[model samples]
Target: MQKIKSIFKTTGTKNGTYSVGLTVIVIAIVVVANLIFGQIPEKYKNIDVSSTKIYDITDTSKELLKNLDQKVTFTVLAEKAGADDRIKTFLSKYSSLSKNIKVEWIDPVLHPSALSEYDTSANTIVVACDDTGKSTTVSFSDIIVMDTSSYYYTGNATESEFDGEGQLTSAVNYVVSDSNKNIYRTTGHGEATLSSSVSELMTKNNYKVNELNLVMDTSIPEECDLLLMYAPSKDLTEDEKTAVEDYLAKGGKVMILLGETSSADLPNIASVMKEYGMETEDGYIADPSRCYQGNYYYIFPELSVSGDMAKGITSQMVLLTNAHGMNLVDPARDTITTSPFMTTSENAYAVTEEAQKQGAYTLGAVAEETISGDSAGKTDADTSENDGESDDAEQEEQKTGRLTVISAGSLIDSQITDTFTQLENTTLFMNAVSSNFDGVQNISIEAKSLGTEYNTVQHAGLFSLLVIFGIPLLILISGFTVWYRRRKA
Candidate 1:
């Protein structure tokens, strides 16, 4: 008993007791830290430090999710073991963003009937809306984009971009919307057909695209919400132009893509543009400062933030290959409001066979005009009557027709394609179309390139020697120095 008392007294010294307490406190801190971190939301926990932010969702997605009226279930058809880490992290962000979004993982091996009702394969994601009983399936291949352009024909092909966010957000929007918008592409004027990438993007965004020939139909179809004319080699006939004018008079939206023309006369189309105070020039634009590979013809246009055409486009530069120049005839037209959404550099020049004109030119522009006289009549009544009802009526009767003109159609042409470089051009085109046809949201997430890397050490032998022997030797020296100091003290 005496020996035991003595032992307790020795162990209960102030320094010993403090050390014991500190150790216990450290263990408690670790336990609490683990608990706290584990409880945090996955979206906040997983920091996306990737160069392209492949896992992070865009602000467009957040805005769409904030207004979600229905519950969306994301069912991943794969075993957790086989699922990719990046994809899993990306999907978790959706559930954390909105309470209406729910994510569930199902192993195909355990329960085959889990996804039996839906036509889904392994590694597929089904975004379903419970309210509408509609669902959209996103294949795994769609998420991982590859460069299929002819530019890669002679070189090694690589994965160009990650479109997981765009695909999943579009799926959510599609399943939740009550109806899809109809887009009509003009035909029979030697117009270029829509590229496969653009077509896939339209389909993913829940747009019903159909071909419309103004010559055969004699009028724009009633189901056409937006009309698209891309790279027409020939000019439109008088009757076709009249049909388009009539369509625009009824609050229609049109997108025209014109390539650089060398003596190609599109008089009827020019007439339509003149009505809206937009004039297309005859030569291609060349810029030294803002071009690809020192090729002056492949110009990069500046994005105009003030215009609705580039409202949601976050890309810094938009490429326009061999583009013509356009000018607003009247910047301050009353009935027609024009905004040059894309412009060339001040030093850029318009190149033609005869001569070169140097100046900043408009490459893309958007025009909005009130075509109906009902608003004008209401305004007249408001001036005469001077009443609050007339003022309110005039405000409610205002409606504007929209038109977007892009100088270069090759920027979006996938057939003459290089997707690795022209991703922003595609996004800009999509944004313009979506903005004009109501508030349909289409998020454009650029793909990340998987390029080859070479890592080399300048002094490989020195590095190996230090790592193999120097660190351990230094540690031993540090311990000995401490012990020696204590002994001397």
Candidate 2:
């Protein structure tokens, strides 16, 4: 009896030792695993579970971050307790995307000297770059855009959008990029000014829009990347016309937005367009088959997908109000190439003072002229060179001048563009002006909604069946397999 009791004690002691060893091994594994995973960035580990993806960055932002080489920092000015949760969450996710991006939160009250150089409020965020030593501020109001237009009547303000992503992305782009295209809007011709939305869009895309009166300035500026003539009521003077002609000859770009005026009245503008093989028609275009509602004058023109201005546009529909039509002067000009950016159907008709005429017409078009540099300065003696020398000379560099014509000045109007939100009127105009520009990375990202989002499921019956029966069946099968193995063991 004594020997048997001793053996039982030894067995209990060995079992206790084994259990402690197993527990130690398990704890060590968990600790090591946690340490390893903590080194990994949160972007790779944490998944955004929000339905509206408010915490997630867009694919455009991702692509920009992927190719980013320069170091960019975002300094948020707020105390830890007073910081906005939306801004903190977004910046955390944003910084995890790229190693070059660093985000720092500093309390304004504690460190007032940190923001001494910046002219911004306590809640504003500043995006800066070390390499360029450039910095730009994004205000709290800029991040949370509000629609107070209707507040006067309603006595309440509506949240337009949470524009944190758009504002931060644009701010970062501005600080790092060195290129800024100057867009000169021609003045002194009683032209309509650009709407606030249009002007803001140009600024966001890194295009510096400035006013230039050809009548007063004598010539277009040397830094002018694009010349804009937005619905000039009065015609340009002869000197102004000559200045425009000279600008175009030197590989310049021009965008003309036509308003309701007779070709007879604006003969100078008509002549300038005719030089590019594009003639402006007199009257408003009406398309009964392709119009908004029953209003034939509010036309929905079809896009010319092949045109450079319409290259990446997914939708073919755009609104043009009170627009005239354009006619190609010469379809097969030797030196000039023409592409219609937008056109009307065969059933379209034009309403003039005299009568209405039925015909298919171009609503907008782009004309490009390639001027050969080799033949410009050569005399008769230079033309007498041997065939080999002439061939080599012909291969010299050439310059191209481009003109884009849109027959509707109302395309840029706030009422029309803002009302027809589904249409691509604003997008079409931006594409036209920015076709020849390079390194244009500005894209409009939809603002995240601050409202509640409900889960929407399609084919409810199928989803219910999968959840109810399929899942149970899978679990039963897995349990039975596990039980059979245990029993066998």
Candidate 3:
């Protein structure tokens, strides 16, 4: 009996020692793992699990952060107690994207003299870059958008969206950019001016908008990066046309939005577009199958998603009214390539004054011409003796000119864009203008509507199967292994 009791005591001591050693190893492993993970950035570890993904930034923002060279700081002027939680969460995620970003939450009461020169009030955000000494201030109303559309009837202003990401990203982009792209709109022809919303969008994308009268100026300015002929009712003058032709010869960009007029009415303007293989028809397009309500003229055209114009445009539907049918003067050209980005279906037809024509038509198209060699503008006979010179000139003369033509003027109207909040008419126009600049990215992120249920994942077949079947199968295998080991023992 004494020997058996001693054996039991020895066994108990060994078991207790093994248990303590195992516990210590587990605790050490956990501590080391936590320390390793703590060193990583918060963006990689913290997943946005919110239903609306309020804290998650889009791929557009990610691309901007990847190319960020200068350090940008966002200074929020609000006390910690009174700060908006949505803004705080977004800024945290934004800062974690790059080491060049820093966010500071400064209360005006505590730091009375800090940033006194800026016109900042409570809840205003100042995004500044010390390298360039440039700063942009975002007001409280810009961050948190309010919808007063219903207030006129209900007498209560409701919250529309938290657009903190859009505002802050645009602000950062403005201060970091080297210079703005100068866009000169043609005036003195009864052309429509850009809407306030469109003008503001242009400003955010670092485009300086100014008016230019071709008759008065006689030539496109040297500083003009893009020329805008926005739905001009009258044709260009003889000298004006020559000036435009010269600008294009030396590599210039032009965006032409045609009004509801025939090619015969604007002969000089038509001639300029004809050089790029784009011409407009007499009347509007009528798509009976792709229109809204019973109105066949208010057609929803098909979008070529593979085109550059479709980049960064999420919402697909665009409303275009009083649009002319587009035709290519030369469908195939070795020097100029013309492709339509927006077209109508086969069943659609154009309604003209003469008669209705049944055929598929183009509503928007882009024409690009690459002029190379010394004989670019010379005739075949003139270049017959200069083959060697042309071969050498090919290396030096590689200039490209682009012309973007949209069929409708109403596409940029304020009533269409402001009324149809769900449609992407404004975004489409913005993307078209932004495609000219090589490195510029258009920021047209919409404000997330408050109190709306967004079902992001519509189809989760694989996820459903894993949750329903995979978990129970693992449990069964674990239970069977434990039972088998105990029974054998």
Candidates 1 and 3 compared: the better one by TM-score is 1
Best by lDDT: 3
TM-score for predicted model 1 compared with the true structure: 0.78
Give one digit per residue, the lDDT tens place, for model 3 in 1-489.
Answer: 999778757978879878999999999999999999999887877777766666778777787888889999888887877777777667777888878998888888888666575676777888899999999898778877788897998999888777767777788888998777999999998898888778877876778999999878877888988899888998888999988877776667889998776667889888887788887766779988888797989988888855456766776789889888877888345678887888887777788778888778888988887765355556799867776675556767766777888888888888888788678887888888887776665765655556566566556898788889999999999999999999999
State residue 91's C-alpha deviation in candidate 2, in Å.
2.7
User: Cα deviation of 77 in candidate 3 (Å)?
Assistant: 2.6
* TM-score of each prediction: 0.78, 0.76, 0.75
lDDT of each candidate versus the true structure: 0.78, 0.80, 0.80
lDDT of 1 by residue, 225-323 (tens): 899998887888888888887777667889999855542588888878878878877788899989988999887788775444554666567777888
lDDT of 2 by residue, 337-356 (tens): 88887899999998898989
Deviation in Å, model 2, residue 381 alpha carbon: 9.9
Clashing pairs in 2: none
- Which candidate leads the pack in TM-score? 1
Predictions ranked by TM-score, top down? 1, 2, 3
